[model samples]
Target: MKPLRKIIFPAAGLGTRFLPATKASPKEMLTIVDKPLIQYGVEEAIAAGMGEIIMVTGRGKRAIEDHFDISAELEANLKSAGKSALYKEVSRVARMAEVIYLRQKEALGLGHAVLCARHWVSDEPFGVSLADELIIHEKPAMQQLREVYDQTGCSVIGLIQVPASEVSKYGIVDYTTEEGGLLRLTDMVEKPGMDEAPSDMAMVGRYIFTPRLMQLLKAVQPGKGGEIQLTDAIAVLAKEEPVYGVLLEGQRFDAGNPEGFLLANAVIGLQHAEYGESLRKSLQEYL
Candidate 1:
């Protein structure tokens, strides 16, 4: 088991859920507070000691690359304006990690997006975090998965117990609980209906994958919507090896959708330094 050294962010989705707003810009570039969604995932990866950030991007996603690149003009302008703090902040984004971008070319699906990064990930274990999902925890969520990987050397997926009625909204897991809170996943179904759902423990976007998982992805045929779903690959992988889903100890937000995006803003905004207090007071008055 090699130490996880890389993280892959699948950022090529069309973001149709966001409509015109995401037409020109990527959903990942939408800001939660002051930082873009992708930046949060990058920061989380860095915090977990994963320095290489491989972004599986697509067309119209150049904004993500630009956001992390050195903005010489903007940096100089901020310096000339005597905004030293702002200059330092802007400069840090470019230096966050060794970011490598690979174009997905086509919007196949999450599993396909991960497959595109096969060259970069090579033969080592890696982490995958969807730019849209934000997990607020004491330790970075991926770090938690890395710990599990350390102990079991098994593939780990982050799980959140959603309401039974909402099972169809996500990939639900069927599992057997181990001594720890870890669930040894026996099966997984993508977006199963309420009656078809195996369990309410929905798979969130964070995952730690062994190299062998890529083989499963390659063998998996297109699923619903004619897209290669990552969940389908994971389900097959579970049959031959142990696939563990850890109940993440934190708040998870599906920031990919407009509703979830707004909720993220409100929740994270309440903790913002410049506006949190004022925002809280205003919300109190408005409510």
Candidate 2:
């Protein structure tokens, strides 16, 4: 298997849920404490050994690109102020990895957004990380999927067990577990009703996909929302070939919504060095 060197992030969502806040800003650029959501995902990809990042972006998302690029004036100002630590921190973001952007002209579904990167990804195995899902773990969650891909030589997805009551909120999968929480998925169901859900293991936002999966994505017809769902393509791929899922060892936050976003901020804020103590104290008063 070719080493997984490329990672694609589908970031073109309109963020209608966030309205005015996201009307002008890409949701991926929303900050969790001090770092943007996309930054966390990009940092996770780099930690997992991926060398290249391909972002599927849309209109009003230019800020995402600028965030990852060098800000020469800001760097110079920091250096002149003798804030070496701050200067290095800001400068390191641009130099983290090779970042490339692709425009998704329309607000198509996730599958279409990912398909936009097919030409750049070519015929190699690649990883996908969704910018809005923040997973906190000892090892990067995408790295866990990479480990499963390396061992099985098949497409692997990050899985997390959700309450059966919540199955309607995510793409559910049916699988048999191998040692170490690895699942051999027999089937996948997208946002099924609670009664129709095949299993409790829901597909999280991390994936390591084969080149053929891209072809499958292209063939997927639009489903419920008149948009092609990635889950539909994955369901087809499972029937045609071996696809596995691994229960990610992490605390995942659905940072795409308001409640989850606040929870994510609290969790990450508690870990922040400079503000952790102050934030914790402030939070305790509210509790």
Candidate 3:
């Protein structure tokens, strides 16, 4: 409630799935097309009227900080080259919002990453977005969850129906009732097995949680991977308060892995206004 001014981004992962590329650079910095994966999430949050950005980072993630900071040299060089449009775009990114970075110190888990921002959030409802999950929609995904949070005055997590075989890969939700795209969650389990899975509706990376959820996260012990799981905390929250699962309407890309990353680039690239036509023609010829 309190107008959802702050959102947290958990960008501390080592990104081992990307191998040598991620060895030096962060997986979040991997570009979808022209912009980095993280930038898309930041732009979406800004579009949803959340101006305060709390980035939870870890060791070897200074690039994430520098990416969002003002670059005087780059801007000056672009201006001198008479690239006014490019200069404005770079300048706009730096001035997008008030960004606050918190070092996670260790690779705990999503729950721990979000818990690190509790002090900054300070008793207000906030949002959590995993940068690797690239969602393309007419209405920003965060805005959609915010709308639900506003109406229910409760925590809301974005949901997507995955295949039964892939259910073990995500936190599956069991709903007590459904109204159109919205479901009132009864229970949720993290990475449940196919046979034990409550439902095929899996939790995505978008979340708008109440301050109380922070308290619940603190109480959660490490689950399967010895990491404090956010789903574990959300399950407790559901038991005490009303938690809603919203089936997000969008094109989602799990750009954390190589295949997904390449797919995201190709798909999103073909939709870019200036480059889409050229890229489409190029792909057609190549194929």
Candidate 4:
């Protein structure tokens, strides 16, 4: 298949889970250690060799746009003051990729949010990474998926095995093994109970999808909670084109929930260069 050259990020969620803190800022803008959640995703896409970064953003999400834009005033101030490190950090963001934003006016589901970026991506295959799912692997998650997409010429989604008891929290896929560690998806059940789940393979962030997904999204009538889900759309697409699930070889953190956020913060915080040593020295005390 042709190289997957674009990545679409769906950032239109209200971030109701983070509430008061997110009232002013999008939840994806919440910082992990230093950079915001969305920046981690941007870095992942850049690492995967993506060209255009199209964001399906919503209203009041200007800060997300500003984060990637070249801040001339900020750069000049830093330069005049000899803050080279700070200036370089700010400048690197603008060079990540050609970032283009599309406003998803409604708080529609993930499928609809992705549909908003169709105009920018046209008929090209693209990658999609959730701004909230923080994959903390040394190897960027999207890069891993990109390799599979490049090799297989099939749509791929990152997977992580959740605990049997926690399977109900995500979209679970039932698949038949087609090759080593790769699955040919048979079906998808959203939030199925632990006992009802096909396997512990929970579909998480990071996806490489074809343009056919747009047509599938349009075909699927709204399902759970009256919104279109990307999982459902993909499942339908699987019936035709080949769709595979790659169990992402990494640690992933979901910052959408309080406990997950704290856990993710603690894990990533300990790895920060400025804080690694201190964090390791003191982590046990908190535990």
lDDT of each: 0.91, 0.91, 0.92, 0.86
Clashing pairs in 3: none
lDDT, residue 37, candidate 2:
96
Ranking by lDDT: 3, 2, 1, 4
Instruction: Tell me the spans in candidate 2 whose CA falls farther than 4 Å from its real position.
Output: 178-181
- Please, what are the lDDT tens digits per residue for candidate 3 over residues 171-211? 99999776655688989988989999999999999999999
Q: Write model 2 residue lDDT over 1-287, tens digit each, in one string.
A: 77789999999889988888998999999999998999999999999999799999988999999999999999999999999999999999988999999999987788888999999999999999997989999999988888878888999999899998899999999888777756788888889998999999999899988998899998899997888898998888888888999888988899999899999998889988999999999988999
Error of 1 at 88 (Å): 1.4
Better of 1 and 3 by TM-score: 3
The order by descending TM-score is 3, 2, 1, 4
Q: Estimate each model's TM-score.
A: 0.96, 0.96, 0.97, 0.95
lDDT of 1 by residue, 1-287 (tens): 68788999998888999988998999899999899999889999998888999999888899999999999999999999999999999999988899999999987888999999998998998899997999888898988887888899999998998998899989999999888667899999999989999988999999998998888898889998899999999998899899998888877788988888999999989988898999999999889
Q: Name the runs in model 1 displaced over 4 angstroms.
A: none
Give the 10-residue window scoring lowest on summed lDDT in candidate 2.
175-184
How does residue 186 of candidate 2 score in lDDT? 86
